[model samples]
Target: MPDFQKIPSNDVIDTLLKRVSVRKFTDEQISDETLDLILKTSFRAPTSSNIQAYSVVVVRDQEKLDALAAASGGQRHVAQAPVFLAFCADISRIEDALVRNGHSIDSNNLETGLVSAIDAALVGMSAYLVADSLGIKGVMIGGARNKPHEVAHILGLPQRVFCVFGMSLGWPAEAPAQKPRMDYDGLVHFEQYGKSRSGADAKKVVDDYDVALAEHYRGQGRQTTDASWSDDMDKKFHPWLRDDLRERLKELGFDFR
Candidate 1:
């Protein structure tokens, strides 16, 4: 039998365990050499069929960062961070390469979009992990998608490309308490979803989590409700947040139709 307890700890493992989203940072900027090393190392992450259908736009200009901050719904962290990395799902390069071979991405479909987005997500995560290991902390800005069209315009991205997400990186000035996560059994399943994994089972997990999260909020001197997590999720997800996203993505040349 394998002895899981005997597994030795390593730097990467420690980094993963200690990972937290950092929004505030000191005045220090990430050195160009260090940024290059992080990006190059992260690009080594697995790509689908080696297509490498992703691109990263490094923004250091205060004006552009400010524009991006507005594009992402006025996220001050985006504007304040020393660097903002926009990880993009880009098919334009692939299309260009295909044209050289007498073909084009004319038949792009949902699968194609999904593959490219997944590729960008993988590389983005790899970059974050690399940065975290080096004591640089940051947060993933999914709000970059809140206004995809504006993001493309700000980044000067071509039609067949979109910012899947953005990341802000810098030296930390504050360490916010790490939030608790959902129960493991609720998220991880063996063989298949458990036989009792129905609405009640799921709700039980969430219900327990609600109480735990309420306590967590109280500990942080923040207000909380009885159903803290669920209430917040409902508030954010209700009314179908970002109703214009599908059309915006279509305008950006992502074919989900």
Candidate 2:
């Protein structure tokens, strides 16, 4: 059996450490007040230079959700979700601020885009954690980028404002098992960067993890091979993702220079 002793003792910390995305949710409606409170409270998330480079567009309208669902490669959860929020990395707002103050930035730089996206991601996770505290379950929608231009067009996103990702939030209808992560020691590093201490070290970690994961799949009644993780990674990266990503970002004013 997997070790549960490694989990945190604090409830909040444990909650964060064990978080798994919930795609299946009930039809229960979330209160406007609770949503507002979460947004307001989680705005305390740190931002690069305090620029606060994120904005969220909440979609509750069925038509818009359905369009989003189609845009996300038929992710029906987006439509069925009680609330969907498009978290945008908004350099447009910062650019406006700097221009009004007689300062202009070359927003075409990749660092600008990176910071904006990082800011959006930080706040999005903060929002998710806050919602989780209230027993709300949700999942992030990276698939929204599969047809990003349409997503931006549907939401009327302005230049220098793009969806880094989205979120579908509601009460969960099913509780899924917590997925295994890489071994704690395998991931954490100290006293400068280090590789596996010996040639066999790498294989040992991989082989052990493969067994753990394959066993996990079997427990879930999933038919998977021992190399499931590597196989999935190979499938994911053999073809580069989102061929139009650069052009789409360019059209949105992120030239990435």
Candidate 3:
């Protein structure tokens, strides 16, 4: 286990800086009170017009969790975590309300879709922060979109309520090493977008990161062979290996138009 010093002040900036994604979890259950607090924290996130166009489905049933695991590309963490939450971009509630008030809303509108997705992401980030504050570990499972339709069916989500992602929370079995980030000078600009660095310079930085990551994983007893971040990213970028989430989103009533 890695020793992490507690930040006494509990300042939001310090808390955010210390948070890391935890994939491996211990065999322990999260208490109902903790779960409630996490959900309530999520609900407090700022929303566009306070529409709060999002909802969460908590998966506790073993069979349902198993199905979700399958939908999430067989990530065992989905089933192993004490709490599995599917954060949704929900336009359905707003549409229903509009109908009841004698106004019709189109689910295909670009603005509506964007707002729902924004709400879901904000709420999910809040949940992660809350979990970290309580010493609980979590991982965001973007892999849940590998089979979005199947995930929606499993969760019994209504039309216009799409699964944006899933989050798994529990006590971590081990602490993961801090992943290296790109140099701030390379990423951040004062006002406008900056000119790109030379390819050689970029490659050198990425190669260094690859070495750092491989060593970090090796220290944790995980196997990895890529000598650079670019190599691993290239392997993951194949079109065939990627899921057609855009089409899935369209089917869930989001309009790219």
Candidate 4:
């Protein structure tokens, strides 16, 4: 087995290791200077081929925040947080640049969409990490995609641009316990997928995690079944989610080819 003791430890590593999503926040707003620092520093995150196909819309207006909260399936944190940052996967500027250089975005396909989304994700995580390191707490809102068209309209997004996700940032009012994660063997592979592990072994890993997660919830005064993770995931995703996402994204200029 690899020597896990060789892993380096640092402030960033410790912060990430204990990271938990923060949904409740104090009334205090993030200052413009700090917000600017977070954004500028986060934009430094690596992008594919330096395409930088992303943009962030900072929303502080109460009316717009309420609308965005509704758009995000009634996530109150989206509105209550001092600020909401809509991280967009944007190829609009790329299209505009192409036009200026005698080219067009007609050649765009799945890879174009994936690259832009990945770029946005990278920057979003960087922003979250920076904010957390500064003692600010927040949660990533994937619910921003629950109403894609409405989100696009609310944010005045242009063609080829959509909110990949959002983040609500502020000082914390509550600190929820970090939930348990799946076993390392279930997630990490060696030279090959699962290495010598069999499908039965993978299933066992998830089953064990289910019990551990259930215990974690119980400790927090939340009732849960022994198969907490599996049951919750099955109920949440067995039917798949946002079934109309493909059509919606296509209308937004990402057809996934």
Number of the top-ranking candidate, with TM-score as the measure = 1
Task: Name every residue pair that clashes in candidate 2.
Answer: none
Candidate 1: regions farther than 4 A off:
1-3, 195-200
Query: What does candidate 4's lDDT look like per residue over 161-194, in tens digits?
Result: 9999999999999989998887776787778886
What digit string (tens of lDDT, one per residue) describes model 1 on residues 97-181? Answer: 9899998777678887999999999999999999999989999999999999889999999989999999999999888887888
Q: After superposition, how far is residue 195 of candidate 3 from its true place, in Å?
A: 7.4
Clash-forming residue pairs, model 3? none
The C-alpha TM-scores of every prediction are: 0.94, 0.90, 0.85, 0.93
Instruction: Rank the candidate models, highest TM-score first.
Output: 1, 4, 2, 3
lDDT for each candidate structure: 0.92, 0.86, 0.82, 0.92
Task: Give me the runs in candidate 3 sitting further than 4 Å from their true place.
Answer: 1-9, 101-103, 195-208, 221-227, 240-243
Q: Is candidate 2 or candidate 4 better by TM-score?
A: 4
TM-score of candidate 4 on Cα atoms, chains taken together? 0.93
Question: How would you encode candidate 3's per-residue C-alpha lDDT over 1-257 as one tens digit per residue?
Answer: 53446645445777687878888888888888888999997898999998999999988888898899888999888888878999999988788899999987764677888889889999999998888888899899888888888999999998788888899989989787777676655565445556344333555666777888887778878888867466677778865554566777888877756
Error of 1 at 110 (Å): 0.7
TM-score attained by model 3: 0.85
Candidate 1 vs 3: which has more TM-score: 1
Stretches > 4 Å off in candidate 2: 1-8, 101-107, 195-200
